[model samples]
Target: MMFNIELKDVGKSYGDNEVLRDIDFSVDKGSFTAIVGKSGCGKSTLLRVIAKLEETSKGTLTFSGEGSKDPKIRIMFQDDRLIPWKNILSNISIGAVNKAAAKESLQEVGLIDKEKDWPDQLSGGQKQRIALARALASNPDILLFDEPLGALDALTRMEMQNLIEELWQQQQFTSLLVTHDVTEAVTLANRVIVIDKGTIQLDEKIDLPRPRERDEKFTYYEKKILNQILGG
Candidate 1:
């Protein structure tokens, strides 16, 4: 049940202020794409439109694939968004298949042992892992990440990145990630799209091999994206 996403000539606005203009973007099924841009550049808006959280002011957004129904989509945000009252297992199992399925999702994020802990009992990174598990428990066909690692410290962020990549490779779900981190984008995404000033500025393919290192080629893509975002 693979699904591909398409957005043709999409434009979004609020009143007189345009957030996205004449955007033409498409995401291939089972590929990881990262959207990068400076703050207020409408990168998140583009994702929201795809997620159908907000409607486009103009243009078409559609999904095409095996069935007539829409694809199953899930989003993981920067905030963990966990229930303080619910234990970790209950949190992931809230809308999940069952407790066993929720436990599997927790295990995938390396937090099965924390299933008994409260959200407040865990650290920031642990909370985010629970959030990821919750999103995964749904068995989404498309997983959207909105800077989920933004709040973690450097080492924990790297670990989370590795976990995400591992799970993504294993699950093979289509992923769209919105991040301000160029290095992270290069590390995780098959393609990187740069949104600038309410429009698509650059769409660059990351041709490097996986388990990516911050080597010369990696930095090259990073610098290129950073420059584009910085208006270089």
Candidate 2:
């Protein structure tokens, strides 16, 4: 019960296609974990299984936290996926019941003033910020990210990374990120798990401390994971 989430012998398959196999991991409450793998390696499918967007073909997932039978969960993805027709504030408010909390979430993402603007009116980074604010508005105890920064430019991506770390530090939520970037994985997570060919290849702890500088300091773990993915 100490763990917020646990996967026991989890597996997923679409007809004959096996996406994940014997996946087993437990995420402690308030921990940040990153999952990395090559394209078509079932990374997204694994995340979807956690989200319950897709049912597991085998095994069980257990969740416990905050004295509630079910923990509140939310997911952020690469697309930002905002409603183009709805203005920024409305998008969040519609999804989140409390309008005041939606406003505060926008403020947390530094988008309080753009509440009335359409999604198309914002830049890519700003749009992603809105998406993040919407996710946070619900105050989910469990948050999942699927390459949320994959589409951003370098500078903006770094900014978003900082935002994520800052928010995680402030809110202490259990976070799971699925990313292809090894550097991003090392920079953001307390633990990094690498997947290959529908199985776990490596699950390593990132010993580096938070507010981590993306300098040569993280090269050791980054290269370790990179080599794992490259089959070196």
Candidate 3:
């Protein structure tokens, strides 16, 4: 097994306004990890730091394994961020080198036939699927998700979750998800990390089996994380 990320004493600040401090963690290659924290608790900042979008104020960060060095890291956000005027094919193919690759990725995300449809023609989940296809088109070795499924209704959100899990299993890409939904975190990640006050509050592995049902153990982990988020 290869190590995907090694972040030690990582901290971030913006002009003396500290947003993250003393963060440390290791993520293994091809693993899915979920980071959960309340709003403004620096969860998103931590994700950005890991993605190298924001330079770390202090600490050492390292990436290893295949594609780990100069890895193609991509991020998916709560908003689909699709261009309204662009057709679906044009939108998902933004990073693709050519049409074939774009069409392949679009099919991978189950939206092949929607290529000619406009963004407004799609539903929330469909737009998210397009965003996912766009990210996949880049062939990223690492995927960072900032609650991309947060905007959908319960049924749609669950459907997207399944889709993400399926895609991850097929690609075996190292992934990190930042979400406020504890259940969602527990349901998807092999490990659940709780961030509080810009620091890691808890790091627990999900030993439950895959295709995880909302069983007792799953519920227990969800409650445990929820309690921490509630400051219990």
Provide the overall lDDT of each model, using Cα atoms, as 2-decimal numbers. Answer: 0.92, 0.91, 0.91
The list of candidate 2 runs beyond 4 A from truth reads 1-3, 215-217
**Model 2, range 1-232, lDDT digits (tens) per residue?**
1238899999999999988999998989999999999998888898888888999999999897756777778899999999999999999886684999999999999989999999999999999999999999988888899999999999999999999999988998899999999999999999999999989999999998777976676888998899999992
**Top lDDT prediction, candidate number:** 1
Candidate 1 on 23-90: residue-level lDDT in tens?
Answer: 99889988999999999999899889988999999999999878656888889999999989989999
As a TM-score, model 1 comes out at 0.98
lDDT (C-alpha) at residue 163 in model 2: 98
Model 1: CA > 4 A from native = none
TM-score sort, best first: 1, 2, 3
Q: On a 0 to 1 TM-score scale, where does candidate 2 land against the true structure?
A: 0.96
Number of the top TM-score candidate: 1
Q: In model 2, what are the clashing residue pairs, if there are any?
A: none
Residue 224 error for model 2, in Å?
A: 0.4
Lowest summed lDDT across 10 adjacent residues in model 3 is found at 64-73
Residue 62 of model 1 has an lDDT of 92
